[model samples]
Target: MNKAPIVFLIGFMGSGKTHLAKHVSGILTGKVIEMDSEIEKKYGAKIKDIFSEKGESYFRELEREVLYEIIATNIHSTAPVLISTGGGTPCFYDNMEVMSGAGTTLYLRPSNIVLLRRLEKEKEERPLIRNKTRDEILEYIKQKVNEREKYYLKADIVFNPVNPDIGNLAQLVKEIIYSSFPYFG
Candidate 1:
């Protein structure tokens, strides 16, 4: 029997990692492990609350733990596994290394303009940019993405588009998977 492959999606917030994972899951036929949701479930608090109460340092630590646990579970699972990770996951600690070592990592990079629009509407729910002004939010995204690009670029594959059209995204993802792992085809 062939063991399942762990597919990890990494990108900035509002880059549509979760949505992409959901779409890919339909094609791949596996459980989608959303890191943020898992963290909330395991810690009994939303990520914003965790960051507020315990600070980002604590949240990062918890994220690391949860990532490891998910990887362990994926190792034992018979079905293919897709992991939608938080924006900052690859930038923290040795997460990028761990993810690359364990599975195929895809970086879904959207333009700064796209990210600003998405994040602005949902900033209140996001701890890091919740307090920033519109201009600040845009600037922050530009700077943060520049800083994190190095880590994100280490992924096995990157879907860098100014604005990716969702209509054919699933088929595109399938192509990526087959190209990356020919045996999967």
Candidate 2:
């Protein structure tokens, strides 16, 4: 059995990190943990409600705690683990540092257009960008992508994950898995 190699997936919201984690977890032979879902379960409320009620600070605090806890799990587990971090996970705290130190970090790195398209369809589910116009979504993505680029670039591996063939992403990740682990270079 392949031991858990500590894979941290990072990207903007709707960039498919969680979806890709699901796929990768299936084929890559690892347990999966999603930071957002973990937080929601812990708080017994949706992340949107948490943000609205307690403000982003509280959510950030919870996110940090969860990410650290997940990192600890990976450190102790013997099997390869796939972790999907929140969109802003790396931007705040020393998450990038923790991730880089503990595991291989991969950025889903979807294009703004693709991200906007995916986000538009799911806006209702995500209160942060709900009811936003297409133009507004585009602008928001641009600003977010810009602000988060520095944090995102800290990933050991970055790839454009959008495509006509989603399965290709799994192959790409597998290639990375075989050729090199993050921070090994």
List, residue by residue over 1-185, the lDDT tens digit for candidate 1.
Answer: 43347778899999989888777777775577899999999999999999999999999999999999999878766556779999999999999999988888989998998899999999999999999999999999999999999999999888876656664786687666666555656
The top-ranked prediction according to lDDT is 1
Error of 2 at 122 (Å): 0.6
The lDDT values for all models are 0.87, 0.82
RMSD of each: 2.3, 3.5
Worst lDDT 10-window in candidate 1: 176-185
Q: Which segments of candidate 2 are over 4 A away from where they belong?
A: 1-4, 162-164, 178-185
lDDT of 2: 0.82
Model 2: per-residue Cα lDDT at residue 49: 91
**Weakest 10 consecutive residues, lDDT, candidate 2?**
176-185
As a TM-score, model 1 comes out at: 0.91
lDDT of 2 at 183: 28
Alpha carbon lDDT of residue 181, candidate 1? 53
Q: After the best TM-score superposition of candidate 1, give how far the Cα of residue 35 lies from its true spot, in angstroms.
A: 0.5
